[model samples]
Target: MKHILSLFLIHTFTSYCQDTTYNHFSVDAEFGLNNPIYPMTSGYDAATLNLWHVGLGFRYAVNPKFGVRLSGGYDNFRELAGTPSFSSEYYRVSLEGVANLGNIMDFKEWTKHIGLLFHMGAGYSVLNGSSIDPNHILHGIIGFTPQVRLSPRFNLYVDGSVLANIYQNYTYDLNSTRNTHGIDAYLINLSLGVQYNFGRKEHADWVVIPENNEEIQNLRKRVEKLEEMQRDDDNDGVANWLDQEPETPAGTLVDTKGRTLAPRDSDGDNIPDDLDDCPFEKGSAAMKGCPERSGSMAPNSSKEVITMIEESEVKFETDKADLSPSFQQLLKAIAKVMKDNPSYKLHIMGHADDRASEEYNMNLSRERANAARTYLIEQGVSGDRLTTEGFGETKLKNPLRTVEARAENRRVEFDVR
Candidate 1:
């Protein structure tokens, strides 16, 4: 039996390696020896010749753990003590509840492809023979089966069951006077069978192993470290671990050392704050941080720096100093240049046309120069290096010959020395 079972197992798994047959419904057919016990005459010993049965069964599972089975079969019985032989045949029907031990207990992963089932049931048996009356007897059954998976629609299993009758008799001859209904009859059957499963693909082909706790923890820690390394709290290109200036403001450019770059000039003087001697004032590196001469005899200013400042000049309403949007954009550009060049200083000179009274023009021109200076300071240039002066109707780039010339003359000029 053991050798046969081992061979069956090897053949079942090797042949059906890729198949999973743990379906919800199944049909089984089996043939085996049924040994009768507890009702033999004085001289008769149980023999194998007349102790066989063949059965067909159907099973339905509610889940992996529990199911029900209904089966019917024919059994033949023989008494060897008679002069020739007394042969009788019985028909059996049964219904049993099945419990799968492998699935319910969640066995080792490799064992998932097999199932161990236990069952118990009750039914009726009918007897027929030439010397005895045909009658029915109540019986009970208990059994266990081990199943090897083959495919989604097939399996191989062995069935071993104990069939017990509550009341029975061995007396079969009318001439012999003997009791007929006092002894209990029991039948032990062991059968090899194949079952075909129907409906619904089952997960019985392979087993899935879960990751252990330590591995899961290690993965979580690795992910956390990666997240920390990737995060840039200050939004600088450098990550937090390598960043020297962690709190550097947003949009601030940084060098390889993660330090903020010296690129901002608050006074629009083309002088970066870090290098400018007077960071709050518009000044030049040559002057060691001092404003240019205010309307002096010979203006000491660089032609290039003066050109850049002149380009930033803004026009005004006849007597107002309020700047236009275009003029504001020019001022912003000037601010950037000043921040980049820390050695430069600005000279703000206000001029006007020969239209208003001298006093009024002078005051308006001062207001215009002061307005430009205030805007530069607000934009982050140094205040001490910036000086405002008014030249009313004086230093006109265009003469008052036409309205265009007059309008051009009413302007502000900037110089960097």
Candidate 2:
């Protein structure tokens, strides 16, 4: 029995090695026996036989879905009868294997699956009945077994078959001659049991694997949507890792290496504030986006800068500097900036729209500038930091041929020293 099992294992392993492919294999050892009753005689009616089969085998699961196995073992049968006190033994050794035809369920992954297995094949064996002078009975055999799998590589196996070719006869003096039959039922030596996954196992083919796609447009879109939900814009190449702005859109202006673009210095302006620079000017790099000017300018020191302007068409309503109340909030906002930056002292010099005497307009301009200055002081600005000048009708910001041009001449601006 050991020799036959050894031969089967050698063939199974050698075949697997030659293929050089991935396959599942399991080694199994099975032991089983059956008992029978013979009640033909009444004197002592109970009789039984202890028939056992023991063997080891190997199975190759070629694919996740199907497999084959070659296995065989030894069979021992002891018969006990009580009708005239008779006893005998039958010994048989068999080699059988199977081709797994198919599986009931599709097993594409490493998960729990329920399925049925159909096995059809047989074994060759040497048999003998101890009572009949003990010669050997040899025969070719055929059978089948159906099984169920509780897990991958684990199963409950069953088999039964019929035997042909050898018979034995024994005559007893106490009764008529009796002849034992040569043909036998295979299920008569049936076995049942379970199998485990055991050692040196491979990863389950059914498990799902993860994937990656480089620089895909769709993935980019998804990233954008996600960023929008988070609210970051500028899309400057800053990624989430380096990105202080969490709301950046996906695919924003990023660098060649996929990071957000460094803050742009398109004009080489020293100032980096995108919102502070004039769009049309070519600003200085060190000045932070502010362009250099050729006109006489007051230094920004202490914020109380003094400057001059020529305007003639600008006008004032009598002595009052009140802008149409509609412009009140606008004027107030300017006042707030002064309050916020206390060093910002402004000088408002008003002018007539070239329609009044220079003296009268100059007087009116001073009063108007003073009136405007009063409003800022009222809005929390320091009176000492402000001054009013009356350029009157002597200066014109634009040609006075048109009323709209005249209107441009009347304005107020902060002067810094």
Candidate 3:
């Protein structure tokens, strides 16, 4: 008996140390009636219903569906009125396995307040009375408890149990020893109780934890990344993933590809149309997109004008032939020079940076030269007087592999004779 008690205590201590998120321990107190049915002396009958039965127990839930309990109880049994008068006190201590039928059967789906439990185990019992020596016996007990939740910390329950004893030596009257040697006595108990729970707010018996927590977290992260990619921080029409200039100023005109539109320069001169004195005529920075005023300076010869055109070459974006308004203004100035010097023919040479295959760059450079020539013709220069050539990367003005040098090389240079 001592070894059994020691094992029970060790198991209970270990269970108490387990980490859990909800309450798993409770204390139960009950008081009601008990009926003792056997081991009475011949010709004596005990009461059909006795009084003064009480019990106290402690329980530990291993999980939501199962647990164990330790309890001690006392019962008072007395003889019927006409039969031989006698009284006995029964005391017992038990360690029992408990099954949470409420959890196992999923009672929460229908009701949150109702629950049930089944318990069974064996224990030591002692019978004591004034007329006889104490009789020691081993007893087996089984019971069911039906409970209703009263609050987070408490429950009301009804318990019914049957206890059967083995190897009884004396009768309930203590008049003589029992005739039978094994399984000689039995008792029935019915009780009302209240259980007080301890630990976290909700007990483990009711909480259900999901199994795929990590996968759900990863999915949330992926959704956040997609939302970031789709956001347009500058409020441009284009999403960040496709916008070439994501930080383009608000209200700026942009192309379908999110590149800013060129500022208006009607005459293809460097000056913007809004600021140019002669929006329709090509001129120098000093003249504000207009012809040199009369008597302002000595007249520039055709050769000097051609030199100025060559000095202010038309620039191109890398691998692109589209003309910006500022570059178109420069081309308009060259066209005017060509019209003024009717006897002179213009040669337009285009170059590219060393960033692509030789054949590809050659084609890109030719496209750039034609782009400038087309603008000159549009500005009223005779197409027959203009010639175009591509110099692919062989005549870079600055040969260093730097951003400024590459920008300098992507240009159209002009010569007139």
Best-performing candidate as measured by lDDT: 3
Report the poorest 10 consecutive residues by lDDT, candidate 3: 296-305
Candidate 3 RMSD computed on C-alpha atoms after optimal superposition onto the true structure: 18.1
Report the candidate with higher lDDT, 1 versus 3: 3
lDDT for residue 281 in candidate 1, whole number 0-100: 51
196-284, model 1: which lDDT tens digit per residue? 76545553321232214357678989999988987788987678888889898886767654788657554567875445544445668
Q: For model 2, how does the per-residue alpha-carbon lDDT over 1-417 read when each residue is reduced to its tens digit?
A: 999997887676656644533335666666666432321223432234354666566565555445566766565544345345533333444444444433323333333333334443444544334344543445444555545566554666665544443342322111222355654323244566565443233312221221122335568889987776554344544444445554546544444234445443323343322432321234565543445655674222222111211111123344455654323333454454455456666666766657667787677667677777787787778889888787776777676657686666555544542
**Which rank order by lDDT, best down to worst?**
3, 1, 2
| Model 2 poorest ten-residue lDDT run | 304-313
| CA lDDT of each prediction against the hidden true structure | 0.70, 0.48, 0.80
Candidate 1, run of 10 with poorest lDDT: 203-212
TM per candidate comes to: 0.42, 0.33, 0.47
Enumerate residue pairs that collide in model 3: 268-328, 268-329, 268-330, 269-329
169-276 per-residue lDDT for model 3 (tens digits)? 887667777756677688899999999876544665555542233576798899999889888887766778878999998866566567887765655787765566
Using TM-score as the measure, name the better of candidate 2 and candidate 3: 3
